[model samples]
Target: MKFLKILEKRKSIREYKSKKLSDSHFDLIDSLSNNLPNAVKNQGLEVNIFKDGSIISEKLDGIIGYHGIMIKAPHYLLIFGDENEVAYKMTGYLGEWLVLKLTKEDIGTCWIDVGANDRLIKEKLNLVSHKSVLGIIALGYPKSDARVSSIYAENDDKLISENRKGYPNTDIEYKDNIVSRRKPIEDIVFLSKWGNKITAEELDTRNYDEVFYYMRLAPSWTNRQPWKFILDGTKIILYIESSEQENNNYELIESGIAMLYFEVAMHGQGIPGYWNLEKLEDEKKYGAPDNYYYIGYYTF
Candidate 1:
């Protein structure tokens, strides 16, 4: 799918009119949901467009969302997958992929973090025994005046903040309902080695500067964009801050969301590539710092 415009247009919508989706629109989303390619081949993510919103918001009240504050919409895009680090990655990728895709359909989405209590969540949702409820996407036609990520509104935007000028879209006038506060590429991208900042000219020369620019648009947990990219010879390796790498499934899902942005940006530019999730030697292979936890690599 063409992504730049959607990436520019994408942001979480917290408020929605309680009107449920029309049958035609529901059918379209159902088709799209079933056909998506799973990030993990062995365990494909299963998605459902739960038509009745109240069944969940009422049942899962205080069980989902950040801090038990649920963002109630008319419907939800529910994701179910195996309980594993790989599946968590798949959860993020599939969820964000659908979120971005749904943007083109004019449907707004928000990643409502499915909190702890997976057992209760599983029982309430009537999910299969094998797969766990990875996350939920509150979906609907967005209310005209309500567009902010309600769950993340309480967060201090100053944390890991960056000026908008650092991105490729220097047209600062095109601000969305929420001003983008993505981490600068200078702080995230390294040269052929760790701790070496990649110059803009070098990034531009390789046509990769735009990839990083758009990748930052991916929605992350609490707006903590804890993803980093390393230019290792022919390999472009992905890593997250070890400090925030693993804690339950939040960061793991964030890693998968980051993976989607990188892949989407690359493919959006007519470049063909995929993220290899196999472990890369961070310490022995490249002597990366303990702070950088290598997740995977993409050979462009």
Candidate 2:
């Protein structure tokens, strides 16, 4: 499917059919999950797939607001990151990648955080010492006419309009009712340094507009949209805001989810790029702190 169409059709599905997922569907998920990293370098992040709804229900009991209803789908993707071996940022990034891959396969997902009783889930999953249940994603086919929170839709629309107005045909692509939008290039995309806006003419690529268009629609936590992309010729450097203070891991995870969306869209459209981890020295020159977290890069 076209990347934009996937983004347009993708929505959080809490309600699902009781039918089992196809073997092909599970195979696709298994392949992606196997490739996903629990940590950047040799940190074994184990992703346990619970195909049985009964097991999911037994494990998810007492999770506030997340009854068996959400997990009643065909399966649950449990993402666990080893605290001693894996950085929280890596966990978030890789976990987000898995979710986006599922999205591309037409599977529905909603990321569940380890809240007050996260320990219960961790114990139920039999995670080893120094490992944590980073998040839970309920996966299955989305029911037609699934209802979404109006507030979520409204926030996403407002952010899209604010970020993606300058591109040609922006209005037609981002009508008021659409659920997502890209922040304008000026607002998010930077030059060699932060705070300096990279103009369309400055971008050497012919596909710059198309790339950013899909990026604006990438999802974020509470629509914080805390990702900054700096383009240097064939390279795109991803930087996450370092000072979320509380829920820093959660914020990084959210940014990772957005990055996966951007990368998938890029690859699906035949834009070749590879992700790397390199700190830009110019970040300090641009008034960004030295303490900023260097997530990774996507170089074409």
Q: Which numbered prediction scores highest in lDDT against the true structure? A: 1
Pairs clashing in candidate 2? 160-181, 163-183, 163-184, 181-216, 182-216
Q: Rate the local accuracy (lDDT) of all candidates.
A: 0.74, 0.60
Q: Which stretches of candidate 2 lie over 4 Å from their true place?
A: 2-5, 35-43, 54-74, 84-87, 115-118, 125-130, 149-182, 204-206, 233-235, 242-245, 268-271, 280-282, 289-294
lDDT tens per residue, model 1, 11-97: 677768877777888888888776877455456578888888888888887676644556678999888887788888888888887
**What TM-score would every model get versus the actual structure?**
0.86, 0.73
Clashes of each: 0, 5
Worst 10 residues of 2 by lDDT: 163-172
